[model samples]
Target chain A: MNDTRQFHLLAGLATGRDARSDDAIYQSLWEAIVEHRLSPGARLPEDALAGAFGVSRTMIRRVLQRLALEQLVTLRTHRGAQITSPTPSEARDVFRARRLLEGALLTEVVGNIKPADLQALAQIADQEHHASREQAIRLSARFHTRLMAMAGNASLSEALSQLISRTSLIIAVYGRGQAGCPCEHHTLIKLLETHDLAALQKWMHEHLTGIEASLDFTASGDALPDFEHLFGHHREQNAS
Target chain B: MNDTRQFHLLAGLATGRDARSDDAIYQSLWEAIVEHRLSPGARLPEDALAGAFGVSRTMIRRVLQRLALEQLVTLRTHRGAQITSPTPSEARDVFRARRLLEGALLTEVVGNIKPADLQALAQIADQEHHASREQAIRLSARFHTRLMAMAGNASLSEALSQLISRTSLIIAVYGRGQAGCPCEHHTLIKLLETHDLAALQKWMHEHLTGIEASLDFTASGDALPDFEHLFGHHREQNAS
Candidate 1:
């Protein structure tokens, strides 16, 4: 019994040690936002968050600052941080910018894609198609993100990443259940593998247009959940 | 004497009111970075800057965070912030991304240019041709920035603004003064005015290529004094 307990303790330590503080926080917050676990306009209190994450407020502040920079969170003076809730006009602008930036990225990387990259993208598409839970949304978002990454331009990739995050925010606030068939990804991969730059560009543009057209921008105040439920974990920990 | 004092007071108020704050710091810092006033690896101390700007540490932190988001500055855990000195490879990647994004912007906006907007762009080129000293460089940079702005996408405009600022930083650090004639701007304006979309796109690609080819990229340690003098006023104010 003593040996088993010691082994369990060592295993837990190893698993905990593998998680870098910042990355873990970033990933958790990102997932929370993407999964709608943390709703739009929900405040992220640094001290409470620090307590929940078993880290310092400084780390939470740093991660929140990074999120603010990405426009995923809005950092206001004295009021603290909240998940960004993009206005309708801002949403339209986000998609328009994505069309331009992602279109260019697709055009550049289409001709350069290796068979392995195409296969990897196909796998993402497959996962996105079969995904029943919230992971589907993230996988769907990552599909375009991975394409931008494959372009191998760090600046463009970083910009696209921010745009994609904001896009997810917009979707969370305004998305309608206009789900359709998921064959667009396969078609895109085929076009890319065939080295058809013009077709790839057209398909990518249409893909974004289709996604934007599917959004419901009319919803307003119904977007924000009450602060208590959204941030209950922090409140509970603080109370404790 | 009363009138004169009031006038002096108003002027002083205007100057003091317009004095650098968080609202203005980002642009000022951007200018400094582009103009090589801030060298890569130079530390930005919050207390020192807050005292200099007559603002709180919060405001300084906000501005530095903005700069870091633009990749113009790097923020470390305990080491404070420093101007980003991108590697040569990063510089190349910046240009490549510019080519793709700006090229697409040119293609899309060429056909949509209003006659008045074209005339305004031509006027800018005319001013650039006659500009002396820093006005010339400022005008030259504005020529490209204005074109992107005219594309009617705020997100693209913002991204391009950051790119231009970074390019200026790169030039200040590595440029060898291989300045060329300003004919390309004239030609680009002519193509746009003539509604030659294909030619406009081609000219833009060539223009960016020409600018890249003209970069000196050989200067070493030229950024130190530039940054020192640029922020020296703030230092002196604090010291006094």
Candidate 2:
């Protein structure tokens, strides 16, 4: 059940392509991290993973690269790959960008929402409110995904969803999930139902801020000095 | 010389990765379209490209997927991938998103601007102003990139850069290259040099609006009805 559930997330990334097995492998590795099977600072050796997944190192590296772009996996020199543990600074930046993005998305979509879309969103809100703590977090993330999907831009949808995914990982290590409540989702729905844009903006800003506040940013970082190796000596000189 | 020149663009995407070959392949395809050697509606067959690049279908597919993500390539079922000719709606949506994102990037970085960053940016502005029309367009795009990099969020910079890349393609197929002028770049630099956020915001909005105005959105789009194929029967039901 656990393995299958994890493949489900990978399937989201690979629905239409003719590469189900490859997608499965990518998601499997991703899921391992999501489930904490792959611990936060542990290195992912290409040879072992390639053998385990019955694929070439090239295939494993492909998945690792995709994950790295999402900031979920950090690829290191000679060191192979590791489950990314974002530094406090990185985490705050992600949250700030998401806040800006989600705010823009909400402003864009709230004006054009259809009745059926609202109905579906309401159902997701209900699921988010009633689900178990772990499931609730996933459902809550899905709420934002559903909202972004309504904007009708493929790239925007993908970008916002990836940000949500990374935010979930951030919350996993630094979260105080207890800070979230169904009342927050309900109020958002109410504002949406009324089509009150100002209220909607206020609610979302507060909601996102509350989430950001819940993260324990004081945790010490566990990042490798991979950027220096990736760019070499000249990168520092060129740094803005 | 041509091959070497193309890698310069790919270097933007591959600054951190170890795979020069993969980056080269991606930029080659990108430049082909950029130079109008491949028309907007041209098909990019995987097998032919794999042979041309002397790489596996997997490698070629990876490059194609990344391009598709950038909206430069459209992946079609049974028909393989083709260069994406975004519809008026898609083009407008992209411009809208870019306006929001670049505006946000400007807002985020304006408070943090340094003298050195401004000086380096002034060099890019000069390049944009004095270069040949072709090189000037590239430099103008680079100016925006250098501006965003100052914000210090790798993901945000990449996401915004990819959006700018797509916007460049949109302009290439539909633009009047003569529409851009040095006065605009100088105005932006003047605003930046003074740290006048309000004027900076106004100049960027008008600047982007001018670029968007130059595009012939009336150019009939050559998009396939492949969204239905990719999303299945229910996409229309849920369509916003």
lDDT tens string, model 1, A45-93?
7766665566676777878888887778899988999899988888888
User: Which residue ranges in model 2 land beyond 4 Å of their true spot?
Assistant: A1-39, A42-63, A77-80, A176-180, A223-240, B1-20, B27-38, B45-58, B176-179, B223-240
- Per-residue lDDT tens digits for candidate 2, residues A200-234, read 87888888888888888655445545565567778
Q: Please, what are the lDDT tens digits per residue for candidate 2 over residues B47-137?
A: 6666555566788888887787677888876788887776767777777877888787788678889989889888987876667766566
Question: Best lDDT goes to which candidate?
Answer: 1
lDDT per residue as tens, model 1, B71-115? 888888798898887766778888898888888887668757887
Q: Candidate 2 chain A — worst ten consecutive residues by lDDT sum?
A: A1-10
> Which window of 10 residues has the lowest lDDT sum in candidate 1 chain A?
A1-10
TM-score of chain A of 2: 0.74
For model 1, which pairs clash?
Answer: B37-B227, B174-B217, B176-B216
TM-score of each candidate structure, all chains considered together: 0.75, 0.78
DockQ by candidate, in order: 0.45, 0.35
